[model samples]
Target: MKDVDRGALAISAALAGVAGYVDAIGFLDTGGLFVSFMSGNSTQAAVEVFGPGAAVALASAGIIAAFVFGVAVGGVAATLLARPRAWIVGGATVAVALVAVLAFGGETTLWRVALLAAGMGALNTLFLADGRARVAITYSTGTLVSLGLALAAAATGGSRRAWRRPLLLWSSLVGGAVVGAVAHRGGSPFALSLAAVVLAIATVILAVRPSTPERRPAAER
Candidate 1:
């Protein structure tokens, strides 16, 4: 593959779609959020865990922190894992995705936070560990902001591929969010069911690709 495969880009967009919708529904229907974007959550969580945070901010932070811890767990899990092993990892990832929704499906509780966080972190970790970070499913707001800036710069005469891809990413995320919102508001079960299907397919595809062997983390090396 060249520096970046178009095929990979295509796949990333699809996954981003899923992430966008899944998270939208999570927030709209469940009264909480966690589609996969943790970076923002992490920052928000940090603000909360320390000081100068709101109630929702603290909760969001906790959710993000738990999700990150879950990511660490997924990373540890990845250590013993391989490519086709991606299916197994992906399955576990989906498990958490569902848990995130179901936990908030009804009542709002503290454990609900843990449930969503673990799932978000796990799912996000699987994608990253598999060398699929190009597929920015979670935290798409940044993607949108970046894409807009890129498009603006491109219109003004930028020549880099950077602008185009991010714009495309923002579009995909919007499309996904729409699909998710419609499906969820009409029937969360159906929406979730559809998401589950997409996730299963995406996971299997990733599994078929050879696992991108990673450089050992500083701790590992």
Candidate 2:
């Protein structure tokens, strides 16, 4: 693969892992709701809305709304920024760090959840190119499905490279969740801080002068 492709894939997988980490932290904090995984939250929201958990339903709706708002903000920022990849990722790192600080203050309520949602939402913009994402880093439902399909294809003699990226993305998420879950046992701050540190490292890696361009291939040269 080309240097640029490698960089994109690397950063994409890293952010996916970060998303999973933060999502796991959010799940633990919220007593079983997702920050990055909207589908899961949506389902829970429905269950709560119809069940006896009216308060929980309201919180779920708020989280969903906050996540959508964050996605919109991230998309606009990526469109307006001069260097979307670096700025978006870097901004997300900062956002997650703020969540860590807030968590340290014993504030793991809606505010922290909003920040986590925004951070992961911004992360999704990192791989956007020509209005299409090269990889989906914030969610893994499609990634898992694609991995399964690729496995079936490989069983029929397909190339291994065709499945490697999806597998890496999937595994990274699971690994991150494990780390986040373990860290959450210490405290919410610890979990958020861990995610922030990884995202910060990812930001630096993307900011460095890479041997090849890390932006979209079709970007102006």
Candidate 3:
């Protein structure tokens, strides 16, 4: 995060917020399943295998597979496109918009869930470096871990500001989740539509802004 510029950091935070917002709606609608937090979904799937049944586990597995497929598609786009950030964000906007459309049309829950998961999976690829996600926007576990490590480093007389980026990402996600839960009371479609709008704005910003050169980690160099 120290290597990343302010513009990229701000954009990454906003993208994480969108992931949290969409994930909250999907989690509520699905009664427990997550659209973005695959680690949680993996745990749920493991428990469902014993508690609910294999069928339920299979459904969770399907969501996970959709997320993986989205990552693959986003990875390819990032590799092939000159403007990876804008194109990838645009793709995520389309996926979330489709979820909103399907929700409004009374489409099955499964389709909406799949699209949400896929969109989030693509969103995580926004800060990819060396074929790995530099920032995991959809899930906070890694962010929190990074925060902890940064705090430790600071306590040992390292850079005191090192923890700011991780803390910002985590806070954005939590704030977005709170807003998402509130908006969800109106309807999933409405909430998801708003999320799509946010993504669209992000896409436009990425399109207009000068591209930031990604800084690879020391190990990668």
Candidate 4:
């Protein structure tokens, strides 16, 4: 977060919100499955393998595979495209929009969940620095860890403001999840459409904004 520019940080926060929103919807719709938090899905899969059956475990495995595939696609796009952030966000927008369409069309839950997971996978590629994602938008565990470290550093006379970004990211995700839960309860049918609209707007902003040059790690420099 300290290394990222203001514009990039804002975009990353917004993306995190989207991730939380979608994840909430997916959780409710699937009744315990996750769309973005692969760690949770992995644990669930492991438990299901022993508890429920292979068939239940396979669902999480499939979502994980889809996420990996989306990451591969986004990684290639990042390497090849001039405006990788915009294009990657655009790709995510498309995936999310498709989920909304399928939901309206009464499509099966499996495809919707898969697409949600894939969109989130692509979203994580939006802010790469030195061949790694600078921000993990869909998950809060890492952000919380960073927050704790930043707070510790501050107590030890490090930069006092270093914790702000991590806090902001985590707060945004929680806020989005709250909104998503309310929307899902009130307007369940339109919850996904709302997410798609948010992503579409983000795509436009990323497309028009000047690209930020990738910052290399100190060792590389």
Task: Please tell me which predicted candidate would have the highest TM-score against the true structure.
Answer: 3
lDDT of 4: 0.83
Candidate 4 residue 59 C-alpha distance from true site, Å: 0.9
* lDDT agreement of model 3 with the native: 0.86
RMSD per candidate (Å) reads 5.4, 2.7, 2.1, 2.0
Report the Cα lDDT for candidate 1. Answer: 0.61
**In model 4, what are the clashing residue pairs, if there are any?**
none
Write the number of the candidate with greater TM-score, choosing between 2 and 4: 4
The best candidate in terms of lDDT: 3
Task: For residues 108-197, write the lDDT of model 3, one tens digit per residue.
Answer: 477679877888898887777777888878789999999999999999999898899999999999888899999999998899999999
Model 2 error, position 205 (Å): 1.7
**What lDDT score goes with residue 52 in model 2?**
91
The residue-by-residue lDDT of candidate 4 on 1-221, one tens digit each, is 67677988998999899889988888888878888889988988998897756776888898898888888888888888888888888899888888877777663477679988988898888777667877878879989999999999999999898899999999988888888888888544588889989999998998888664543446743
Q: Best to worst by TM-score, what's the order?
A: 3, 4, 2, 1
**TM accuracy, model 4:** 0.93
Worst 10 residues of 4 by lDDT: 212-221
- Best-to-worst order by lDDT is 3, 4, 2, 1
Each candidate's lDDT (Cα)?
0.61, 0.78, 0.86, 0.83
Q: For residues 1-221, could you state the per-residue lDDT of candidate 2 as single tens digits?
A: 11227657887777888888888889988888888888888888888897899778888888888777777777787678766667778888898898888777775688679777877877776655677555778778878877888888789998656778888988888888888898889998877877888888877787774624545456442
